[model samples]
Target: MLIKWSKDLEIGVPFVDADHKVLINLLNQVDDCITEQEETTVLGSVLEALVSYTEYHFTREEKLMELAGYPSIDEHKNVHQKLFHKVRAIYHSFAADRESVQVDDVRSFLQSWLTSHILVEDVKYRSTCIDKSEAAKQAGMVPFINTNGTHVPFNEWGFLRVLLVDDNPNFGKLVSTILKAVGISNIEVTQTPSEGLALMSRRPADVVLCDWVMDEMSGTQFAAKMGEMEIPSKIVMLTGYSIDTLQTKVSSPNISAYLEKPINAHNLLDTITRTAFNG
Candidate 1:
């Protein structure tokens, strides 16, 4: 299923939030078309519309940032350019030969980029650029909570180093992108646990995010090996299976936290915080 628009996604900027809703709707349309296996012409039309509107929104946003005297306008524009180029490239490739490219992959890339941008980068300008719309007020009033119903403090998780080991390359790429958007720059992504261990041996990461089931090594075994090697990295296991087994497996001291599969920004960051600060 595709992600939905929520209050936490709001950046307290009315115009930006409004543009995001339209983008979210279009994004959902794209996802639905891909999932439903719609016709090529219909998908192409929607893709073009999404790309065009995204350019327009970025331009308008840059102008507003300039007017508001945003400190990071230039840096923000650079990020916008990166997204624009990537989307345009995908559009051209997709249009040239519809069969040459996978539409589902395109949907994944789009979903990752749009949602992460709104939640990570755009929110940085909220204090300087916002209107007192009812939407803004509602966004402000809504409190962000974790799974345990505790308040989430969006603090600085950016300082820590992260090593993400997962067999699925696509999932690894998506998680890496989300981590960067959240200001966690020092990240090393490896497809196998052995490769991850080699990297960690060179320089230990603050947190190690590993998948549960892999061909070479399981997450529990990986944690045990790290403990023996004295890597000093907190293990955050990622699993899609039942936690009943995982609860007993991740009992090692190095295993800091275990997160379920279908990782999102909130849970990923929350787990990292818990391990990073010894929570």
Candidate 2:
């Protein structure tokens, strides 16, 4: 089914409404490609394009809402983030194995999501915010550009520095790479827990994502040390074990969250966001 935009989809914001039209066109293209039995590569690229453009549009919309001092901005942002995570998960699934998800299923999901979002979600901000032209001027004044050149969901979190401590060098690099993918540029990684401690003593990180089972010093040991030193960085323990087992081992109040590896990108972002906001 082709997703076509109508006047009802307009949120009284020209640029936002225009971007909605472009999104509709992209979703329609994906639907058309699915009906035509296009190659997996062709469909994947369209899905990727849709994801990229959707993120850009959401960022701009959020910026406008913030500029206008929209009352429900946080809720609106939460909705955007949930949808973004869903679409990104789908895209990653397809990228890993195209056959895992059918193109028609993705097309259907996109059609339903875009239509409902524009009609119901976008409409919420129509009468609340200033005119789109004024919003555009304000948005242009401060483009929410990421310092690392990757688009992250939170504008306030771009400056957060992350320190990754793992005994395995490859594991440290892998985690660092994943963090960077989500626009986390200011990262310091060390394979030894002692090095991590020394680094934090000199220049503390905003968040410490450490391996639970390190050889030199375990994650729990490091957390204990941090607690003794009164370092206030949010510690996120990355463990392969279950929470039940992990809790028994290292139940420090200093450890903010536990992420079971392999760490999901969305969950990592959410954990860091919550940790920072709470801290």
Give all TM-scores, in the order shown: 0.52, 0.49
lDDT of 1 by residue, 101-131 (tens): 7766887898799889987999888887775
Clashing pairs in 1: none
What lDDT does the true structure give each of the candidates? Answer: 0.73, 0.73
Cα error, residue 194 of model 1, in Å, equals 0.9
Give the residue spans of candidate 2 off by over 4 A. Answer: 35-38, 140-279
CA RMSD of all predictions: 12.5, 11.9
lDDT of 2 by residue, 1-279 (tens): 486667777776666765677677666655655544333444555566567667877988988988787889899999999999988888788769766777667766887898898778778887777465687666544432333333345445568889988775545544454455445788998988998999999888989998898888889999999999888898999876786788778889989999875444445666776776656
